[model samples]
Target chain A: MKAVERVDQFYLLKQLPKATALLCKEGNLLDASCSWLEIFGLPPINKKQKTQIFSLLPEVEDLIEKLQEAKSFNLRHEISLNNETRHLKSYFAPWFDEKENVIGTIVQTDDITSEVEKEEELNWLKNIMETKMEVSKTGWWEYEIDTEKLTWCKETKRIHQVPDCYEPTVIEAIEFYKSGYSQNKVSMLFHKAITDYQSYDTKVMIVTFNGEERWVRITGKPFIKEGKVAKIFGTIKDIHNQVIAEHRVKEHQQLLTTLVDSLPLNVYVKDLESRKVLVNKGECSYLHKKPEELIGKTDFDLYDREIAQISREEDIQVMKHLTPIIGKETVSCLNGKTTHFLTSKIPYFDLEGKVCGVIGMGLDITSMKKKQEELCDLIKITSMQNQKLISFAHIVSHNLRSHSANFSMLLGFLNSEKDQEERKRIIKMLTQASDNLLETLGNLNQVLDINTQESETKKTLNLKKSITGVLHNLSAFLENNDTQIINNVADDMVVKCVPTYLDSIILNLVSNAVKYKSPGRPPIITINAIKSDKGVLLSISDNGLGMDLDRYGDKIFGMYKTFHNREDAKGFGLYLIKNQIEAMGGSITVQSEVDKGTTFNVYFNEES
Target chain B: MCILMKKVSCIFIVDDDPITVFGIKKMLKSVADCKDIQIFQNGKEAYDALIERQNLGKPIPEVIFLDINMPIMDGWDFLDEMIELNITEHVVINMITSSIDPLDYKKWADFKDRCPYILNFKNKPIFKIEPNDLGCITAAS
Candidate 1:
């Protein structure tokens, strides 16, 4: 090459990104391209001049020895030239005349710093991603609309658990997702973004290289260029844990909501700043409004001023204590009525341990309190019964013992009298006293006998059988009273009762009917049974001498209280019958009038 | 006492009340011939006497007037004790009490299987007897 043309070629080479140089056998520069100067960032050099290349570029001395050992040799190596080592490729051969031999070594020095730096940055990013176990990286890939190029970021390969060395075609990458729904959805998303230039966000599962199924969220955005789709890009995120956590949170929230709604108690919560009310279903009715209506509204808007003020004060107290408070409060409604609530207010805390609002749960205790009062009344009645029984025992002992003592004393006097006539008269008086004593003893024994029958051993009995037994036993009495009996008792009706007590009850009622027949008409007795939800109702009605119900209905069951004066009528029979029936968990009621018939309804609890 | 033992066999009277026992014992003197007339206040004491005598190989009483109304142990309790020991069934047992309850009669009537040993239900005193006076023997087998 001639020297004049060499300068022009060297100038043109300086603008190239690659460096160039030429060296003679002595390691001096016979000629060097401008790229060499520019690579070292030095000034331009003169043409056709032998220069000391080592002095200018001290790092080139090691490269010269390597080049001399082999002819037509090429090598890539690094050297420290400007405080930083840069890689260079060199070619070496022997000089020849008109033959293919290297006259001097032609070394191409490339700065390659940018390329190496980019590779190092990529490796650093790879190591950071590989070590990150908590924040998993996901990726997506795309291709240009009209180009044969495919592009994927490192995160994209990682999301599919593919190695960095894996190079995939566009179609192959699309096939990595599950083949059915996922493949269809991804295909649709790609087609729509490419054709319509639309943006899409979707979630899908993909089978990774490691054979693990993973859920990823993809957000795709397309760019349009010249009315034609240019490129599409998207981001994929592992969102698996977040998705699972969100789903579990949703289920728990629904369960808690259902539990709160199903509870009989009223539950409500309010936001302090917004003054919005949130309530369970039961609490909605208590407010006389729907839950939606109550939402975004304060208690003052829906309730009376007193109620709102009291509720707000209660909420403030709850917030101050940061605990629950339980008590009773009267909530006045706009309807002009106040309801008593067994109320509990609690402060709800946010994640930062700050009180967000107050929650209140209440139970309406109006009916329960009424029932408690009734139970107290029953207790009082039981106490009165106990007192009455004690008094009865005392009366029996006093009256019977006194009469017996008088009879014994009279008999002793009769025995002491020596005069025959006076003894006879005294004996007669003693006999009369003894008879009175015996009568008193009988009455007392009858009363005490109830104590024995008080224990009602229950058994399942057919109503018809029991009534039939009573009728058969009272056949003679019914005939004597000339009474006609009509029985409409349900034959299959079964009741749980003490058999003996049931017999006695039936007999007493039937006999009463027969004895108290109306004077003008034959005594017609009706015995009917009805099955009700309460239990079996037994009604015994008689067209006999009925007393004025208004006057004696209240006292008919009282002890020693008799309305009829039949010779065999003992006032105590009906009284004992009523007590016996009541003690067996049954009740008795009588309806009668002065000239009309009497009907006694016996209600006994049915056995399940 | 030897002549009295010769004149009558032993008769045991069991009752709770002292007056009733005394009256029954006094009235029994006129009704039957008896040598040994023993009296016990309650069924427990009477049972003990019978057991003690039987253990000594002495014959138990041929006739026993058992009072149904006694505290701690009554005539039924005595009978139960006797039956458990397999006492002689030929010996007559009469339940004597002043209780005139129809339920008591019903209970006694229903117990006919154990009644051959029980001769009758008798009222107290045993003083008066008439041909049709079922009063002395309320029920008899």
Candidate 2:
């Protein structure tokens, strides 16, 4: 019986697949396999007493009882050993001896942990693949170029709205693309892939299994084997949303292009390196060239060296920063005229907010700049005249006050005096002072009248007629001075000037000639007006006692300036004559020599 | 009944015009009570005489007639120097001129703050005095 029990233990241990075992008798383990020793947390290839195994694995008694209950009984059971976390599947059977007597129970266990882990991994992989197909909404296809065999993933079949078992050949795949350019394109692409191993990426419309049209983007790469086409694999993507978005963007760009080109101000955009990428019609016109000529060129190509250098520096500044710069500068056009322009340059940026290039716009402001300067000059002149007028007012007031006060005081003294002789003396002196004051006031009034008179209401008047009238008015003076008149004036030459001013100007010139007649010789006056396209050129030359040009050239027409002594020469006439001519937009000039003849030349505007 | 009073002692006329000085002296003799009167034709001549009299221990003129509107020097210029020189402490100065300018009137009215030095203003040699006049004998012996 003891030998049979030992044989039973060895048989159980040999039958187990890498399992531990123990031999037991009378509710105690007698011997065990080396694996059994290790299973019980003992050293390798070492055995322990059955009593120790029975104490550690309390369920061993139950397995023994079940083993004794039936002949050749086979049962599988789980046993816990020493509270460890490993599960053991044990096969139990009754042991037999050499005499074929039932002696003890035998148990065997095999670990199945790795097989379970592989099954879990396969399930996880299937879940991940299914989730990917659902999320990406993508499908893939492979084509065997030599065999013309095509395979589609399940998701690909679903995307085509077809059944799971559907199979399509290369010809069918090409036919699946709609007829027309799509079919042609696919045929060429597939032929290229087979012969030349060229890949293709394109969008095409297709009819699905449900008879519905849909847009798809197909990308392909060919597999080459031994320098021969083997197979082609690619992806089919549903990019309908992206295609629509791109179409809208193209439409918006077309509208914006039209609007920018129509603007009067020149507008242009540069690329990533400040090279001209876009130019509008107005911008091209400034260069005297077409838009195509300006493209791919920078400012240095279009502008002169100095201007281009300045503009390029500004463009570089904008490209290096995110701020906008605006400046006004003059640009020399092809016509050689400098045009003032207000320029604005701003940085262009990509969506990531990095500096890309610059966009510049220029508004032509040449006329506006000229007008502003003219207005400033007019303001300066007006203010200067205003200062002179204020001073004139003060002087007039002071002089007039002094004279009036003296007159009033003289009147008071005359009234208070009773002595006949003294009153007579005072009256005579007052009369002389009043006469001088009257003369001064009269001169002032004459200048003021000429300055205030408006010449805008002038009409076309015959210059010869006005000059003749002046000669007639001054006939007595000329006769008294024994002045000889030499008239070679144009007969009907007309000019645009106030008639009264023309008469006054001629009268003053003739009278001055007569008044300054030489003492030794009679004055000889020559009057002539030459008619030309510009205007009538009137000259009045006098062989009189003329003054020195060096001394009187600047002050020849100044008010209260008298060169010769004549009782009626108040010196206000020439000044008034000059003022009148200027008010009518005419010019007067004089040439003189001391003790020689003087000549007055006048230019009058001719009406168109 | 009024007690008799002595006439004004010396009358001095300071003016640039000799003719105006002669006219004033003749008119003053005809119009006002006068005794011995002396006339100086300019501020410098008049200022020197007053200072010399002070040195000689003689009484200064009782009446001095000053004129503005003169060449080289005038009445107001004389008053400025006279105050500095202290030439006359007891004499009365009367400004007389042909200048009827209101600005001149206002200027002289303000200038009268150096009173007794510039006592009053009259129109030239007419010698008309108002009720406000602080009358001192203009010419006396």
Best by TM-score: 2
DockQ of 2: 0.04
Once fitted onto the true fold, the runs of candidate 2 whose alpha carbons sit more than 4 angstroms away are A1-235, A238-265, A268-277, A284-328, A331-338, A342-361, A391-395, A421-449, A453-456, A484-493, A526-543, A548-558, A586-593, A597-608, B1-141
Overall lDDT per candidate, in order of appearance = 0.71, 0.71
lDDT of 2 by residue, A1-608 (tens): 66666566576654454654444444345445656555555543223422533455555566545645744443333444566444445555556679966666555555444554577799999788767866887778998866768998787787678899999877777777788987898788878877787899989876788886777888788988898878899777676678788889998998999889998888999976668988998888788888788889977787787878788888887787767888756465555778888889999888998877888889989889899999998897688558546645754664465456556656766777898998887787677658867977986786677667653467888777777788888888788888889889767777788778788888889888877878879999999888777787889999888887775576577554455544566557887777677656677999988778899998886652
Query: Interface RMSDs of all predictions?
Result: 13.3, 8.4
Cα shift from native, residue B114, model 2 (Å): 29
Alpha carbon deviation, residue A359, candidate 2 (Å):
7.1
Model 1 chain A: weakest 10-residue lDDT segment is A398-407
Cα deviation of A155, candidate 1, in Å: 3.3
Clashes of each: 4, 4
Task: Tell me the lDDT of model 2 at B3.
Answer: 22
